[model samples]
Target: MIAYVGDFGLARFLSDVPQTSLVGVKGSTGYIALEYAMGAKASTQGDVYSYGILLLEMIPGKGPTDDMFKDNLSLRHFAKLSLPKRVMDIVDPVLLEEAKVSQGSGNHTNTRKRMHACLISMVRIGVLCSANSPRDRMEMKDVVTEMHAIKDLYLGVRIHQDEQVMSQLSGEDPSYLSYY
Candidate 1:
């Protein structure tokens, strides 16, 4: 499969031929969807599962094959178990530190809250997309839409923060707060 980044910064892959079953499995071990191992054909659903793994990896900065994923634990389960709570524990330390620094500059309670929500939503999408059953996984289009929504929320908060900083620097009225 050939992969390229789409306009939304999402990776899109193209397969030259239609779906078909091969004699044997071929793909990175951690990324190959479970169905393929069970003699299922190459499919969009498999691709979605791999994409989900990719998304999950982004949160904790750990690959599926990481040493920590031995035994019953896996990247998917690790992320899924932390959802809606314990996000900070699973999130990358660098990101948490960066958030702390950003929160120090101003009244960042709103910023912190928005960021937390975005993180939870992202982990949820990853978990949904990587469900064990292909039928349970989200479609690629829906994943893209949900991702865009999260991106918008994140960027909105960032933009507001930037404007607030600018206003403080320029001694302008705090009118930008009204827009958010």
Candidate 2:
């Protein structure tokens, strides 16, 4: 890994490693896409799949090779099954708790909505980038655009509405807000 990093100056391999049994260059299992494993011609799609796996791993604080996964369960499969509805269960407990505490104490519906949107966007991006079919994966340019948008939201540069996050800390859900 160090050798590749030093060569490319990339923190990790974004280009596909040759599948030859010769010395040098070996791809890790689980992270490698089906095409790469099948010894097909390499493309940026393979890297997108790997990046998707990496992003998916961050949400649950688990790896593609985690022992808890059994049978047909993979990190991608787990993420696919636990989105939007049960996402809270899959997210790291500390992050989930922090979201709840922020929403609860801040008592701001806009902030809560923004947080949900941010998480959903992230999970959706990961899933899209890591789709089994290369055709289904997002292009690197699109990924960069989405990532910038996410960063903007994360930095509190609100995109949708100009409403400020309420400063008062309380437990009450605002009465006027009706989310449907």
Candidate 3:
């Protein structure tokens, strides 16, 4: 549901077709595939790779930067090298809020535990989708499934907690907690 609009001038139209294609030997640079930069024909797979990058940007609130790929460092390389730890560092603080509320009561112990678990799952999915080898990356359908599951679980937990708070506010007996 997210869109990244880079310079359309960077996109070129083929003489024989109406469809536009990315220009320059390097395409858009930060999120482009190696095949695109190498002059191989761009495919949906290339777009999927860029979509993966876009997904990362949505979660982190920062698009890929030239610095991410500098010093022989590609985003994929950095993510893979760091895996769960450093990858979590780049996650947006918004997710931390969601994770905390998802855990209920906002207790530090519960929030930290839930956030850690959610973050780990998120990093795993992101890493899979952003694999350096396009063939190794997941299909869009699989990505959709995984993302849905994460959202469902996170929201489901939060909703249950909300119901509890509502019941308490209404002065309903706490014993009713078992029903929800």
Residue pairs clashing in model 1 are none
Residue by residue across 11-108, what tens digits does model 1's lDDT show?
A: 23324433456444356668878876666666688788888888888888888888999899999989877855576689888777776776576647
Error of 1 at 159 (Å): 10
**Tens digit of per-residue lDDT, candidate 3, span 1-180:** 245534222234322333334453334556775555555555556656766666665555656673556788655555445444455676678866765666667556544544444444555555566666778777778778766755654444555554443333223533422211
Question: Across residues 86-165, which tens digit of lDDT does each residue of candidate 2 receive?
Answer: 65578887776766765565536666656655665677678887888888888879889978876666556765432332
User: What C-alpha lDDT, on a 0 to 100 scale, does residue 57 get in candidate 3?
Assistant: 59
RMSD of 2: 8.3
Off by over 4 Å in 1: 1-25, 98-106, 157-180
RMSD of each: 9.9, 8.3, 11.0
Q: List TM-scores for all candidates, in order.
A: 0.71, 0.69, 0.61
lDDT of each: 0.68, 0.62, 0.54
Point to the candidate with the largest lDDT.
1
